[model samples]
Every structure is written in C-alpha cells, then in structure tokens.
Target: MAGQGSGGNVIAAICNIFFPGLGQLVQGRILAALIFAILFFGGAALWFLIVPAIIAGIVYIWAIIDAAKYKGP
Candidate 1:
C-alpha cells in the first residue's frame, strides 16, 4: 500500500513537472489548480525580468513539491 501510494505521488509530481498545477487538477484540487496556474503563467509572463524568472522558478518548484505532498482537504 505504501508503494502504491508513493507511485501515485510520483505520477502526480511528474504531471506537475510538465505543467504547473496539472497535478492539482489531476488530484481534483480545482482551486489550487487555478491559483497555481495563474501564478505560474503570470510569473512566466514576467520572464523578461530577472526577478520574475527567479520568482517563477520558486513558485514552479513549490507547485511541484506541493502537488506531490497534497493530501486533499
């Protein structure tokens, strides 16, 4: 059971890796998905600035880690 659960987490993490918030959507976290997508894309749009790039990277990494650990509220 532990392995199975971890497998699911790995899958979700992979999904989020490709696209921010995708794992949240897959996990049925609609609000989180929307929020993450918005923050991710918004930050990405500001990529011309070095700060936004760093911020976006941070948010993107957070999204991935969050999606992996999310257990539904």
Candidate 2:
C-alpha cells in the first residue's frame, strides 16, 4: 500500500468506519487487523458494563486513525 495521505489510506479509513480493523485487512496488516478486531469486538461484547463500550468506541476510532496514518515500510 501507499504511504500515509495516499488514496489507499483514505479508502482504508472509510472501510474502518464500517468495521474496525477492516482497513488494516485491506492494507494487508493481518496481525494488526486481528488485534484491532479482537480488542474492539471484545470490548463491544461487554457493552453492559459501560466501560467496555467506551473502550470499544475508542478502539474503533483508533483503528480508523491507525489505518489512515499508516506509512508503509
């Protein structure tokens, strides 16, 4: 994928808006994708606790930013 600020990053960010970690998957970041997916989903699963729901929201936003700002090595 292209470096940060590229079209790919924009698309990735948009993808992440729909589902956490999807952007990373699109970028071929399997590990990051798995981690984000797990963290977000896990937190979301505990929504009844409130705190976990907040954490999930944070994770979701972070995933979008991470994907958008990712600079390929």
Candidate 3:
C-alpha cells in the first residue's frame, strides 16, 4: 500500500538523517547498513566537520526513494 511505502520512506529518511546505514538496518540490509555507518562516521571523524552530514543528506534522499520503491518484505 502507499501508506506502508510512505512509512518505510519516512523511517529511511529518519535513519539517514541521524546516521547512515540506519535505513538499511531497518530494511534488514545489515551488511550494507554497517558498511555505510562505518564509512560515513569514519569520514566524519577524519574530516572533523559536517561533510558527513552532507553525504548523509544525499544518502537519506536515496533511502527515501528506495523505500518508496519497496515492493515487499
């Protein structure tokens, strides 16, 4: 249903906003989620700025799109 799709999109957006890979985790994409989390957080640590946030924003949009496209569990 559209509602379910939207809900997933919201969750994905939230996850991507707070931390990369979170959306994937919610989607049961454990490996991908972990990879994204490490890469994003690691980059933040190395850069010492908001670069990760910017990257996360992009990823968040991607996640939302993916969530909207989700067809099943």
Q: Return the lDDT, model 1, position 67.
A: 75
Q: Per-residue lDDT tens digits of candidate 1, residues 1-73? A: 1332577667777899999989878777889888888888888998998787788888899988987776654
**How far off is residue 4 in model 3, in Å?**
9.1
> Best candidate per lDDT, number?
2
Q: Could you tell me every candidate's TM-score relative to the true structure? A: 0.83, 0.96, 0.59
Query: Which of the two candidates, 1 or 3, achieves a greater lDDT against the reference?
Result: 1
Candidate 3 stretches with Cα past 4 Å from truth are: 1-5, 48-73
Q: Between candidates 2 and 3, which one is better according to TM-score?
A: 2
The C-alpha RMSD in Å for every predicted model, in order, reads 2.6, 0.7, 3.8
Worst 10 residues of 2 by lDDT: 1-10
Summarize candidate 2's per-residue lDDT along 1-73 as a digit string, tens digits: 7699999999999999999999999999999999999999999999999999999999999999999999998
Output the number of the TM-score-best candidate. Answer: 2
Ranking by TM-score: 2, 1, 3
User: Model 1 TM-score?
Assistant: 0.83
Clashes of each: 0, 0, 0
Query: lDDT per residue, candidate 3, 21-58, as tens digits?
Result: 77777777788677777766666565556787677555
Give candidate 1 regions above 4 Å deviation: 1-5
